[model samples]
Target: MPTSNWNIMVKASQNPPFAAENYSIAEIKNEVLLQIRSGKDFPVTSAAISLIGQLTSEQEVPVAELANVVLGDYGLTSKLLKLINSVYYLRFGEVTTVSRAIVLLGTDHLRDVALSFTLFERLQTDASDHIINLLCRAVYAAVVGRRIASQTGYTNPEEAFICSLFHTLGEMLTAYYAPGTYAALSKGITGSGAEESARVRTSLLYLSLGKEIAQSWRFPARIVCCMEKPTVKMSEHDDVYRLSCIASGANEVAHIVEESLDPEDRQRKLEKTLKNVHLSASLISGNGDLTAPVEDVHKYCSLYGITFERSAIARSLNQRREENEQAQGPLKRPTNNTAEDAPFDLPPNFNGSSSSPFSSLPEAQDDSETVFTNGLREVGDAFLEECPLDDLLTIILETMYRGLKPFGLRRTLLLIRDARRPAMEVRLSLGDPLASIKSWFSIPITAIGSDVFNIALSEQKHLFVNDSTVPPIDGQPLIPSWLVEHIDRPVAMGVLPLHIKRVSIGMIYLEGEKNFFTTVPQNYLNYVKILHQQAAIAIRQR
Candidate 1:
């Protein structure tokens, strides 16, 4: 359908891709340690902190002077001045000085200016998507800040808006410093063949980077907190969290017409995200008269030269109604299955028998096939319609664990998309006390240093580790080592790629006992595939 909603176009299930540098914190830490050991001067943390203050100040700073302060030994003032005048910064009049521009932006904004300049100066290289992406983000953030100020009530809304806009700074920095780590994460998630989950995982990874960088820069505690929990945190009084939420929400809405999203899906996702973040639905409904007289949301959009119409609200709302009707109607799954629908057969059990789920059948033959038996199909369907999205996922994982018990598989790990961190977060754990930690920090899946991550994600294929002697994937070596050494307990593990359509969603890790396949069954792989399909749909709705 021709919809004007950006969120629907972007797909809430798939968060925008973020550079996975943040989730690569361990690698960064290692680099820091090595630099310290080698006595090589690492980038001074103080420099990052100082740069923030300088950028926010109102000094009309020149690019050269700004560069001088940030780049330290570099005398690239002229080049910087040129960059400042580029089409990116909408400065008119023949004011050729970087200092003048700095003054106009004000000290409060100088932090962002300095940050923008310093980041570009340090990381600008041919084909470096990190700096380019950060610049795009800066421009996007500034515009978002301006529009948010016009649309909402808050003192110094511009300042608050700007802060919210650059919330993903850490991700850029991490991407620049550690491209390998970021690539690994991207590959692991995308290779999983679930585009939706891949994007969300990327976003989570990006958020993690932003949190780290914000902390590294020692920006305000509230700003840091807001960056960490952009969609989940509560602020004290009129804080950045509120302003950022509104900005993000507005950005989502604005993008619908300006970008692409099924207006209906956009509204639905926004509604849910806002509720999840504890924002009063009234505010997002655009009924709150918080907008100020000087504030021109349309003008702000114009300043950025992006097409946005205030009058489109009516159209958007109507589209949303149509969407609700469709959503409420009978469910018909998309027909074109991506890699997620590929077929594979199960292995045989040891007793020279098929060892299927049914005792009469050979062990392998019994366990391999999954039929729509005994209300399982209905249970799955009901689970889809009634269960809360997150709870639905939890139950699905729990069911898989139970299903594997007959084969002696004990532990299972499921990694799902989390927007706050923008990476694959460990959703549930069958065993292990470490899994209980509520705030399980996510690492870029690509950094796991194992090919298993690649095989599971990219090949959309299952991995069987009988002897644990296999080498690891590019970023997921730990999985193999863990599976092999943990064999003393239960070692049967299966990696299932999850996706909807061509959009990759996420992945599931199932583990049973060492002698798990004593009786292999038919279509066992297909059963898990169904689990992943249902899980993805539930997550998308959530």
Candidate 2:
């Protein structure tokens, strides 16, 4: 949201409000970049990556020298052999050793193969579907971009392959490092947003993150330029321009194919996007002057799990265009086309015409209740879902953020109720970085008011203060001094206590845009209540 107006809100999206966790979005990037520069973030320049880089270069790399690097890691050697041997379609003889595979695949083809396999081996984590999709897109784009590069007669298609492969580096890194922020931001990502493609959401976010890492690693000037893809115009046959165009085109096509559920919608969008890269629908569909490299696209799809035919693609694109022609309607081209390498921009602000605090409220599709219930079920598992203590709290906090409609609340905090101290300690704050990891929001368990959030925790009841300035129960200003010390202004808040067999354990506190807390229908509030009650039941008696 923050292009200034939502800076705090957008910044809070990642810089989790935890103890001493206050950081601007820029600061968060600097911190992450520092770690990356120190070789602490992602394994970008591992031995395998370095060796693959050498293999990808123009100079002839000695087979014995390349094999020595591969031989250092038993796992890498085995994988190299298996991958080479598995490419039965290539009709290559079985490659039983890394040395032979290197010689057989040759310098150029070998580089492409090694880069893909090395990256797969390095960045592979216990990834979720979103993360896996991110990884897959990088690899998919690499293959597709390489195909495009070869057709366009780029000097080094291999270079284009790698550049396109890491185009989403920022997005993938965020998903891996800060799944919390990744999950939080993921809801509104529908690919084509009001200003840019849905993928632009993270792209806008991670461009800086990716650039810093790429630069720090001292990658080639052209590759780093490709990563930033700064606003510029280039002549035809400009190597940099061709690389950027092919990579961008590949990614756009991959997104249209993979993310969109509606085939007709997918086709309609793909044509408009390809235009930005100076590619026509006819070229891609093989109906143009240049023969379409349909085989390359199909091979990439089959190698990955895309599992769709070439005819299906042509049918979607051509049929949609035919329908538009018959109606005399011009197909709408999205104004913010990242595929063209347009000046990267943010979506309009939260209160601006395009978005809102509730922009991403979970839709039920056809069944309303399942939306909340299914989410709660997942949260229930998380509450008891054993994890490393550090990660356990993060999962709990993130689950709570989603369990409550993410877009519905401005700020929510997880508080650990301490009976002996008669107070609550703010453990986590969602969407409010100032409250995060700080005791600034703590309130005594026995706050001297009927509507105070802590009273809800102490009494094991759901407490809703419709207006903090005026009491809902008896027309008194129930907002306590402890709360006033923390809140800069009057605000409404709710607290639902966690209990085990009706025994109070802790509480969940949520605050929204002033009176917005009161506007939530009781039925929706009950969903949050049920979430707490179910999570409490799952907590083992300890």
Candidate 3:
């Protein structure tokens, strides 16, 4: 470990070099960088990048498509939904599904989100605590930089973010992949003096290499420049310079927050950093707590259903006693990529039904047409060991409800016809999952043709009526008298009689925001019929 002999003194960043056992530190660093630069497969990055690239292409990508891609990587998908619901991106409320997120972010923003996440996901593999901490700091800087840029009237805050986030890519790659070199080079990192500063200055070789990687990826020049020349003057007229200032200023703030002992010092640095970006110095003057950015990161992680390195951080802050109990020995670092924690493998509402209609559909095809389908089949094998027939039936109805969701059907009622009487009773209703059914409990089975529910029941057929399409008879409505009397007003409705083995069980009534059915495609109505038939079979068998 003598300073005079650099070769013998070289120690690894965290562990042994992850290269050919005999390779030197220089060869290891160069080899790893070369692999990332041109190799067809990257140990961690390619799969993430490829998947993200597919999901974020120019064409209109369906929510189903996003969900489908995420099925194989359920934890990743959960993180996406969680991130979408994070405070930064959250617009409305809890987004239980990917399709809902598409509606909110639109395709372009979704693409950006996918890109950001894939980068994060890829870096998570076999990363050391130092690197993970650095990545989180980068993320915090990115978020803070974006906000700072926006407050300063810079147009592309997202560009500012990616540039800033990737600024530490070299350091990250070296720490995990070229540990020997990182270890040796980081040996002199001891002081707040010029000697230490000189050592860090020498470390710029990796940062310079990071810029090359970013450039190779076809990133905008300004973005590449922001990472390369983040020390550019904040007062410059050009967007690149301004962006660099914001990104650099935010990174400095992140570091100050990470290192400062006094809360007031951190607050002062944060205010100064904000002012450097032309943002109001008073913005974050109230809080100097270093954990604020970490909290936001944890909040975002929670949105992704991710509980790992950061989760441990959050829990440790609140569980010093628990941490002490574990302090009896060296602690094993819990990995973030556990397969057991997949958030959407079986959503709470799906009730673990293997017979879900989403199973029968063709495996998601890349042909734009079916690319947007959900991944029920992805986790189709996972279902309740004892899923009762009733749960399956409910799953069918819920499928229909979500299927017709694009058509805006707000209510669907399944009225079963009792053998003892000519009355159709609303045995199951969908809308408010918790609402009482007693109010819509029953309807008489009239013999009239105009009686939508009765005609479907008697004829054992499906009746889909678009009120707008039903021409008026002598200027009077063609709908049944029951609808006119019992309902608030006439609206578009579809009635499908459920039958099994030639015996009538019930009829389904689908109501929508007036004329909702008119816009619904014929294929959708056909699917509804299939669901009705499926439900009937399930009921009869059960």
Q: Which stretches of candidate 2 lie over 4 Å from their true place?
A: 2-6, 10-25, 34-61, 86-94, 104-112, 155-157, 187-202, 218-222, 228-233, 261-264, 286-542
> Between prediction 1 and prediction 2, which has the larger lDDT?
2
What does candidate 3's lDDT look like per residue over 141-229, in tens digits?
77667666665678877677666676666776656555556655666454443264434543565666566665545444565576654
Off by over 4 Å in 3: 1-29, 32-44, 54-72, 153-163, 192-203, 215-225, 234-239, 263-294, 303-542
lDDT accuracy of residue 8 in candidate 2:
38
For model 1, residues 460-517, the per-residue Cα lDDT tens digits are 5556654344454454453544334435653545667666664445777766655455
Q: For every candidate structure, what is the RMSD over all alpha carbons to the true structure, in angstroms?
A: 28.6, 22.4, 18.3
In model 2, what is the error at residue 84, expressed in angstroms? 3.6
Determine the backbone clash count of candidate 3.
Answer: 6
lDDT of 1: 0.45
Ordering by lDDT:
3, 2, 1
lDDT of 2 by residue, 324-439 (tens): 45676654446774322221111211111222222232222223255455545444444444423322333333334444443355566667766679767765555554223363
TM-score between candidate 1 and the true structure: 0.37
